[model samples]
Target: MPSPAPSSPLLTAFHDSYHELVRFVARRTGPQSARDLVHDAWIRLAERQRSEGRRPEAPSDERSTPSPQNIAPRAYLYTVADHIAIDHLRRGQRTAQRFDSSGKEDGPAFAASPDVADTHTYRQALAEVENALQQLPARCRDIFLADRIDGASHAELALRHGVSVKTVEREVMRAMDGVEAALHRWRGETAAPRTGRRRALSSLLGLAGLGVSSSALWLGWRQWVPQYQLQLATAKRRLLRQPLPDGSTLTLDADSRAELRYYAARRQVQLLAGSAFFAVARDTERPFTVEASDVQVTVLGTRFEVALEGDAVLVAVDTGRVRVRDGSGGVQTLLAGQMLRLPAGQSAQPQAITAVAPWRDGWLDFQNTPLAEVVERLARYSPHPLRVEADAATLPVLGRVHTTAVSGWLQLLARTLPVSVQPEEAEGGISTLVIRRRS
Candidate 1:
């Protein structure tokens, strides 16, 4: 065989991390097929990179590149490998079904029995479900399959489809309703008007009577049903603290929003915007995870703060420990008093923090942070809209600004930096603060 060409930066990284990538896929698809899936993933990535190179550049083209600064090669490779593994498993399932239908000798045989009619009815129900799925919109049907067949998480589906987790949940529910209605018709059961939310419960009970395994039923419920869900938000200049169902406490900063989802197997909070402080209760069985921007912070029991600051996701650990992973697959472990900042399309590095979420105490701390980002955080608590000019926005700032005394800080800011702070009254009697270069 001819020798392979020298590897590019991405290919080199893949070669170096081949074993680790195999192990990642193995945990999902088993060790036997992990190597093949990882290799296939690399091939797909290489092809994608080539295709991207040939395409015209556009403002919205955020494709992955080999540069370490653009993305974490290992993380991107893992994501590709994980998707390939799912497809591999799905193909295997389809192939097995085909073999069984062909009456292969090695396939399991059904002996003649009095329960044959039940078997026929069960097969018919499955056909009805398939037919119902085909009638759904393409995206809705795919979301349903990804949830039920591939076991993708709601967060994962949301990310993949560029939608919110709530949207994913709605699509899955729509799919289930269609399938259940089809099954009802197949079973000759009269459809009564449902007055309440017992439809899922009734559907599960009906499937149980059709001889679905207890384990399957339990898994289905866990995948599609939520024990409880809560939406938390804070208005401008206001802070709120609320207790979670798991006995943990969540403190939301001004202009922040989060969605709390408690499942039988996990506890998740999607930080939709702004920042939050979590004082978690110890529960080893169900780990707690907070998703912000493209980053995830996971802990068993910890006091931590996650903030979506500008284009970065900031995770600060006040106590205990946290595992933070970004979209590109970069993972960092932070201990008490440590913090990690994941900037968009950049590598993350852990640093020490003197305080976590000082904004909770009415203080905004900046350490060589961009002026624009500082203004953004301040704007959340400001009654008036705040805007920073392009020339002044990039200036580095290092100081603490009291949240309640922002006007005073603005006076000092004008004196310290070559910038002008101007407040203008707009229509609707609202004042807007604009920061511009002094020149």
Candidate 2:
């Protein structure tokens, strides 16, 4: 029988950290190219060693090796692997810039060339993304990495975690938002390129003299129009204020998201999820409309808040009138100091309110609102989900609840209402507060 050839010292080092290196690269370049990058790393390591005149030192007896430390430092291997992965990315970017044999530039290429990739700005963005992932909660990080890096579907994650598909979706959304928020914070001072905006505006103005107005230009732009999405993650505990193209301001609550689209006929805002307060600009010619959950609210100019609560849409007007039309052909008008709740399969009914959109002022006023409903609202600002069980869920809650300290309010519920709050005992460290009736 012939004895198999022993692997080289470099190969041994790579084999030891193979899985870890693949995961690390996967986090950056995604899973599809992770293995290729890993192979590139090994080749780069050998080339680097050869250039430095530091060839792999082979031991006489491989079996006599003391430990992994004696073979090669894992840190050195990982460092070399990272450098190789980065260089691979840079090369890819450079390739993207050059025209192929067809004499056409790869217009869809977003990869940075070696020169651009070597810049500190490029490295900083990469670091920011990694740091953002690190900052996510354990469960959230697991779900995100599993779904993104491991290519697990939402159903798989839900089944693995024993939760619903909606929960998995929310976790993924949270992970993405966390990364975006971290990058935004790190690059807050960085100014956006004004050339594109200037060009867009110039194009619009150039057409205005041709009897076509800015709105008409926007209508045409809608064909290839770009849309911007804003996401507020759980890690971002502050409200986000965004200025729309038409000068309107949008204030989003924590853990909220929305998409903005501008056109000549209308300025549309889609509440993809979560709560938002819109201070719409007056444009009678192009009415502002907010579409959320099966309902659409239109207004020329108004200050109002729209919250997607379960299967219902809560529309509260602070200043101007809001016309809400449901999917079932039901329409109603809400004036200032009035609110309406349009539940699924129900018409919009106006209700009187002393103050509209109180949450904007850091106060949540609910007159005889169910404890379950209040808990649900508070869950948005809370880091964890809130669960009210037994009779406690039906208790009517009145007065105002402050948004700053939801924990204190929950304790108050225990004191005032016949309920007790406690953390649930679960296999995974799921952050959930359970409120049950006091025995």
Candidate 3:
């Protein structure tokens, strides 16, 4: 044979490297595309080598050049082929920049699970709860909400209202109790005709049985029946010791609302909005679960507070261990006093790790908390909009706050800091707070 042309090194090398390059691509791109990608890469390299009119780069060892008897042409061709294939692939990848065509976008998506946490969703939910408040008694609702949503303490509430501490406590408790009962009625529960109340009504009906006015029963449903909507959107409270068939003992905060779904074996409470401190009674037989936004806080014998704030779920373990499961199959175990602030998006890691919760003694503890946050927390109790300018809210503030008189604290806040608090008339109701930079 014509002692193969002296410049045969390139061809030999290409043949040698080809297979290795294909295998490498196969691993990186998976088996399906590996063959095509690698072969394409090899073809492009061959064209480039041909265009340049250069022998494929080859090992510079001539002394050991294989004799014709041991040319091993197949292996040699593959050797050069591998390098050329990989280089071609790299170049093609850079030029093409293949788009991720997996339909699902790269960023966040709305989800019922903890996977998609949207701040807007949480804010909107809170807003919905606010709208539902319209259905509740105004004064009673305000007082009840002032306690939880506002972070008001009994003494502070008493002092602010100029009422004796005892009366303040009584009124707060009464409001909470009434809201609880109101919610029960709303859920369409019938107050069984008590033997006495029934007899009295029966006697009245017997005397005027023929003339029993239709308006009488209409008035009766309004007066005697509880219209608590089971799936109510408003903020409310719940306090109980015994397992309500579903086996959950919840110490619901003031102005917090929840949807109770009692099943044969499972008692599910969807905390649509607001905060609740739950001490789930042990029922080895049934599971006590509370769904707050995207987080499912489940426990059989644990005490924890799950608050739906903005678009985040704030799970704070008060006593015992509680497991908070997020939308993305992420489960976090919270110990006492540990507050986990889980934001939107499926984050295996917590978005914000906070210090000891202050609401243990029914008071909010603050540590290097922002002034704006303080104002926000304070707004819950008062009939005023409290806001923190972006600059001010971000400024680190360290202090302890009572739930009562969050608005009053702002007065003191102005006295202590250079920040100013102003009201926005355009925003209706006291809930809307628009903090602006002071001129």
Candidate 4:
């Protein structure tokens, strides 16, 4: 270098607390890579500031150099270092998993002799993805990678970054959108091939005019297209367990129906009718969403249930955080042991809950649930239709109803509530339980 750059106030503070920062990182990642993690953290901090169009101001004299506290918050530095350590450890684990006893690389790698044009395009796409990730805000990038690559939970990320779980979810979504946009740009550029000799020449030249083969274009498109599409439904009184392409599991309640569309960028389920519980696979790059009428529930990875009850949509989280947005653009976040109800023409309000989708465990738990709604749910398990009169439809019912014993539960319901059950035989000899207010 012509001359070493003068130390800025921030750099000076970093130097002053270098040992402490390394010690902090060591506790999380062990002493092996602690110093390197701290160094990387400083580089990340400096790069972030540069990207924001701010250069650190250097003190004129040694005496004027501000104290470490005045220059930069030590806590921020520690946070950056902690994130770096997490990434480093995660990468190390992956590396270990990739190599065999003979040290032969077993992870994904380029073919020993791949097609030149296709390889070039692939490398370009990879570079674009990396560039897009780098352009993201430091916190956003770290949070996304930690959740996706390191498998860190949103709550853990929030605690580490000193932010709410909602903030963490937003940052992850932002990062994913950024990376997806970059991939789309790369695909758009490479998907179209030039004509005839020009295309061949461009491939040979390996210049800015590079052209990919039609086969390569098809392969690229395949990566972006839907990987799996399925329509799942349960017969009356039957429960269905389905495994998704991405390793998630779906349990459909009796008479439930759902459509699953899995793409490279997203895993979506349209809850067309009844209720379904999703044990989502974690892929922060591809968020999982459940669309239920006017309400949409989104999560990076979690176990939750979505149900369509008449004009109302119900969402409950058994684990992880879930974000629910209504047709009116109102958003509510539900944590573990929390539930939300969105009625037609009304806003969603999240409430604390003791159980999430108790129906999954062979019982339907109702807390002051309407009689009509309860009857409709029970009808799914009953061989005969269950109906309630208008006067008793709005009556509030409480307690658990075992799915296997709907008849017994109905008997108890008729006993407790001011309602009588009348068994009506239809023209086809099909019996129906008709409940009416007691005379």
Best by lDDT: 1
Model 1: number of clashes? 0
lDDT of 1 by residue, 1-439 (tens): 0011134455556757766776888898776556545544554554444556531111112343343335666665665566666655565555455435556756653322226664554555566766777789988987876765554756678889999866876787688678767767876886566432323322433543332322233344454444557999999889999999899999999999999988767899999999999999989988999999888889999999999988888999999999988878878789999988888756677898999999889999999988999999988877679999999989999999888888778867987789999988889988889999987
Candidate 4 per-residue lDDT, tens place, 307-345, comes to: 999899999999999999987888888899988888865
RMSD of 3: 33.0
Better of 1 and 3 by TM-score: 1
Query: At residue 49, what lDDT does model 3 achieve?
Result: 47
Model 3 lDDT, residue 39, Cα: 37
For model 2, residues 317-383, the per-residue Cα lDDT tens digits are 9998989998687888889989888887678668877776666788778788788888888887676
Error of 2 at 214 (Å): 19
Candidate 4: give the clashing pairs.
none
- TM-score of each prediction: 0.57, 0.48, 0.42, 0.52
Name the lDDT value of residue 151 in candidate 1: 48
The RMSD (Cα, Å) of candidate 1 is 23.7
Q: CA lDDT of each candidate?
A: 0.72, 0.65, 0.51, 0.70
Any runs in candidate 2 off by more than 4 Å, and if so which? 1-236, 428-431
